[model samples]
Target: MSATSRVPALAPFRVRSFRFQWPADLATSWAFEMETLILGWYVLVETRSVLMLTVFASLLYIGTLLSPMFGVMGDRIGHRYVLSAMRAVYAALATTLMTLAFTGALNPVQVLAIAAVMGLVRPSDTGMRIALVGETMPAPQLMGAMSIQRTTQDSARIAGALTGAGLVATLGMGPAYSVVASLYAISVLLTFKTGGSRAAPNPGADTAGVSAGLRTASGERETAEAQPQARFPQTAVAAGDASARPSPWRDLKEGLAYVRTTPHLLAVMCLAFLFNLTAFPLFHGLLPYVVKEIYRTDQTGLGYLVASTAFGALLGAIALSARGGAIRPARMMIVSCVAWYAMLLAFAYTQHLASGIAVLMLVGFTQCLCMITMAAMLLRTTDVHFRGRVMGIRMLAVYGNLPGLLIAGPLIARFGYPITATLYCVIGLAFTLLIAVRWRSHLWRLEAPANTR
Candidate 1:
């Protein structure tokens, strides 16, 4: 059978809203990656300070920590308007920053300020992901949709990094920023094409008027009449259920409570926290340094390194797509995590550029696989109502290692690369083993739902 014929036809891609959402996600990824490379390169070139680089990188993560409040607002109002407004703000901010850079008026303080403001808009990015995915596809096709989303994101990172590097090398940071700003504009346009109504509020809003009416009615009525009413409080309860409910805090709380009680999730989060603290900082800080020092290269080489990892990630996502089952997500996570650490260790120890590049490709593949597994597990385990909030908190936990980024450069500078890199890999390996051992039972739990069978 032909490739297209062998695969079962799932759903028509003619759904206009779904078509728009996919491209919107692609644009968001492209713009985000472009901005990251541009800002990091601009800062390093201008200041030559690793401390400033760390601060610049931390801004987005700091912004991610505030996502839950935005999520709460998304639940209270609607994600449609929130996403649209935020994308507009993001475009405006990028344009302004680009203008300043082009004018040669951009200072370190101004750059950092821009980063912080950009961070504030980061929650909308998360909110859009939740809203778009929910609006675009049915539950049966959601996993495939998510895989596509992840692959596009990784591809964008690769493309953006390469584009940004070439732009910076030829035209300068100003033009790169301009390109990024234009991508954001395209993203906003795509976002506008999605169609969906907002979710209804919870029951609490409806009861306020009924409660007032009861108080007035009770006061006006005689004690004998009120006695029977008081005796039948079930009527009041039924009325309350009809009321416009409070926001989704209870749903958020339920997710939080689950993470607190679920040993498996807790183990995963702990591993994630440590893994992020060590590996993420190394990528943002030391990876650039490695390109500069070990390879005797420039920003373009850094871009190629990033692109290599992204290519590996694309391959890994494709493999996961081929195996369309939800078996042992946690075990997959553990194995990927271990593989990621081993690759990083190899990258750190290798002096040859080709060897380092090969190791980084492995690192990228395993890291993304781990992320996909974790995302799948989290979604399957949590309730639909609470998924957004749980995802929000997960974002917070995963990036909570932001402060450690600050220490990464300083540690490398002080202790030297070999010592620092060895310490990181050792710590990462120990934690991975510990988590795997402790959560072994939970990791293997793959009780298929009746519907899937």
Candidate 2:
């Protein structure tokens, strides 16, 4: 049998770089899940306050505003180098936490302080990882690669959530953090194995796929008015190109100006910020509160609840990978976002553990489908050079989460879980529809360049 028939799932591994990158991404995400759960639980139990837990969680996203700078750094240096350095920092911080926990010096205050340091680099992780994949993989493999990449995170969430709860329960925080530290070290090692001493690949100009420049919803091709006489290099060949040697600020401005002119990209950012604001807070940081107060569960129950989403998302990522390019990302994202919000609405009213898990599974499933498609859509339409910076700007959308989480604490305290969650999900569903309507030509149309098959 040919390679495709022999092992379709492993096709992305044919590239030496991805072979290393995949494992590295997997380990890093696994460690992150473990750390988040362990620390979030500690903060909640110690302070006995949902407000403090939200503050701790919000602090973790402090680096999000600086994501564009991280992208610019990746564009100047290699993403692999940037990633290696970042993972190393992760290892170091994990070790510091382990030491504090072991010495009986670990407290919520100390945890928050350390988490602030970790936050300075964590939010940029996904953007850099995507930029690396786009640089290393061929265009034909982009969908499959993104799908597989998402699988690492989805699977990690399942593994990490369950394992972290177990480890902390049985062995206590110090020993549990030892595992997290070790995983970070493995991630750093694997990351160093990628990028292979060669300069990053240059994908040349924007693909003929995107070069059509403008398409009406009816599928007619037209030139856009703001379309420049020459398209910027899609994959910036930065290392040796004399012209690529401009100031980082100039590069940032160029990336911004280009994105501002692109209607689809602007729409994508808006949708991203919307989801981060209205949807993510319920599923992520705020879930701990929901578990303790609403579901009336301990940390193990919290683990199961969180893993339910991961398990569902893991299945969705696998399905997307198996289907490959058959799914158009932009179309899928809009549909899934609507479904995702609906699931959140279901989750808000859930009280029993079994029913809560069931609702969260659907919530997780749809959330993963929506986010992976959004990321793939961004990577697919954006050329390589700008991909990093574009993704970096995309990271800025995550800044919405900070405000969302901050708002959620008081709302939960005053208005209660069901009412606050209902408000959030309803708003998300309404805005998702508005976004689809607002950017119909760029996002809703089948033949739009943003939906390139």
Off by over 4 Å in 2: 1-5, 196-244
Error of 1 at 65 (Å): 2.3
lDDT of 1: 0.67
Model 1 lowest lDDT segment of ten: 203-212
Measured against the true structure, the TM-scores of the candidates, in listed sequence, are: 0.82, 0.91
TM-score of 2: 0.91
User: Candidate 2: what lDDT?
Assistant: 0.84
Tens-place lDDT per residue, model 2, 1-453, is 657457776677888899899999999999999999999999999999999998999989989988888888887787898889999999999999999999999888999999999999999999999888887877667778888999899889989999999999999999999999999999999999987543244343244334444444576654323433222332234333545455677557666755776788888898999988988999899988988988888999989988999989988888888885788778898999999998999888998999989988998889888888888777777766577788899998888889999999999999998999899988888888888898898787888876776
> 1-453, model 1: which lDDT tens digit per residue?
544345633231444566677787788788888788878877777788766777888776777666665555554445555676778888999999889978999887888898889877774475457545654455554445556667878899899889988988899768888888998898888878776642232221112112222222244622213442332222334456423343355434434555665566567678768876877666644567778767778888888888888888888877776664653567778888888888888877777667777877888899888877776555555434444555666666546457667777788778767677778888889988987787766675554221120
Q: What is the C-alpha lDDT of each candidate?
A: 0.67, 0.84
